[model samples]
Target: MDRSKQLYEQDATDWQRGMYEDIKTTFRAPIVNWYFRSLTANEPAFTRYLWGQLKPLFQTRAFGRYAVSYRDTVLSAIEDGPADLPRYRRADTALRPAEWRELRGQLATFDVVAPRLALTFAVCDRAMHGDLPDANPEGAPSTAPLPPWLDRDRGQSVTMLEAGDVPGDLSETVDEIRAFHGLEEGLPSIYRCLAQWPGYLEPAWTDLEPILESEAFERGCRDADAVVDGHLEELPYTPRLSPNDLAEQGFDDETIDDIQHYVRAFNRGAVSKVLQTIVTYAATLDAGGERSL
Candidate 1:
């Protein structure tokens, strides 16, 4: 798979553009994530089919509650536990009011998408591995109707600095991010976006880096994974992403292998770490009342 490839929204075909719009609407965010974009680039038909199969997992009230729970899990751990770091606030930086607002809005987009991505990875990872439950577990919760306005109108489209374009002043921070995520080259999209506000991203990473390395943060990631595992049976629609299923849907063997490899790569460690990092960074902005809860 061409991991670096991305199908930008402006470059999408009409059908792909429509799908992107539907994705933005369904995600309740203004931007499509790299996962969707990369999949679209690989094969628009499979991406469309995969999205349709996965959409129901995010639509139910149970999933909304899961999103909140996921947020609270990370925040409460940081706020009440041994992360033991002082919360960084908007005033901690010299950002102008407008810049702070834009920062907050962009961070909010990451915050909202974090949990959804976690769940998506969970479903896709398990499905790709044949680890999904064959039937609803005995005591799973109902796939309740989704509550309206859960994180609606909260976040703006996320914009990121290119990995190569990250300012030299933030090289240490960028290096730390790349090292921690085990990337030999290029930074994650979240860090690239955070790089846009070096003053904020620098201190935030300084404080967050230790916690991300801590036992508490590790526990939180495991807990986050369990939250999704615990809900596998309750998903309104299980993803039809197994190799056979994809092949049956006209995906070639190479595409199926690539999809599986990609899903597993994102699912294993990267997505949860990114998810938690986004949540922790966004929580810091709200710590001093600069952002709404």
Candidate 2:
């Protein structure tokens, strides 16, 4: 346990140092500040609005990357979990193994999204500086390969939506589905309150015409289809289940509601932690009298 504590402290110190360096370098740019302002907009309401606009851009691949990154950091800390000894010693020693495991799982989930929150902050900083990346040109060739980090199908989904090939209502439905899958945080309450929203499978075959009409959109569809097909074709032949099917599999209404509430609360806490970390690191850089941009 003492060894674990030492390792935890060591890692925490390293993380703090890396954060300081990041603030002094990449985060010091005027673009980052601009981006922050755009996303956060000084008002809580605006923050929600910005999230509504951006949430659809998050897809399964992106979510998977977030989850994996978060899981790795969290699991490492768990091996060092008992390292909170100084504080533990000062408090009750009533910790149980199950509780510890549960707490660790929560931390892992939190870690998964922390870097994404950091990236969002960076994007906001850039927007504030009027340095937003140019919107991809209309009718541009869609054949350009995606970044290795991106989920291929998810990227294709974004390409289709942005091209306006999908009906606006259908696109919004897709966004809602992504949000339900734990992709990102801050979905508007209005979206949540709506009932009987169109499911992805319900989209009419006729409605696909617009998507197929644009060459760029068609390319995206092909790419996304390839990804979906590959997943379907892969080992141990399990059938794909729809969202409704998953929802129906035995949880009581109260339990489902509780789960939703918890997910929202977790997202709020994670966002708060990320913001606090960024601000603290930025302050350290400022104290050193470093000019960022």
Residue 242 miss distance in model 1 (angstroms): 1.9
Model 2 over residues 111-163: C-alpha lDDT tens digits? 22233444444333333333334433222112222234331111000001122
* Tens digit of per-residue lDDT, candidate 1, span 1-293: 78789899989878899999998888888888888899899777888898888887778777776788887776666655675755655678889888889899998888878888888887887897788876462333346666667878789778888878999989988888888877788677788888899989888888888888887877777777677777676766657888788878888888877788888888885556878778887877862111222
State the weakest 10-residue window (summed lDDT) of model 2: 151-160
Q: What overall lDDT goes with each candidate model?
A: 0.78, 0.29
Candidate 1 regions off by >4 Å? 135-141, 287-293
Candidate 2 scores a C-alpha RMSD against the true structure in Å of 25.4
Q: Model 2 misses residue 219 by how many Å?
A: 38
Candidate No. with top lDDT: 1
TM-score of candidate 1 to 2 decimals: 0.92
Per-candidate TM equals: 0.92, 0.26
The local distance difference test score of model 2 is 0.29
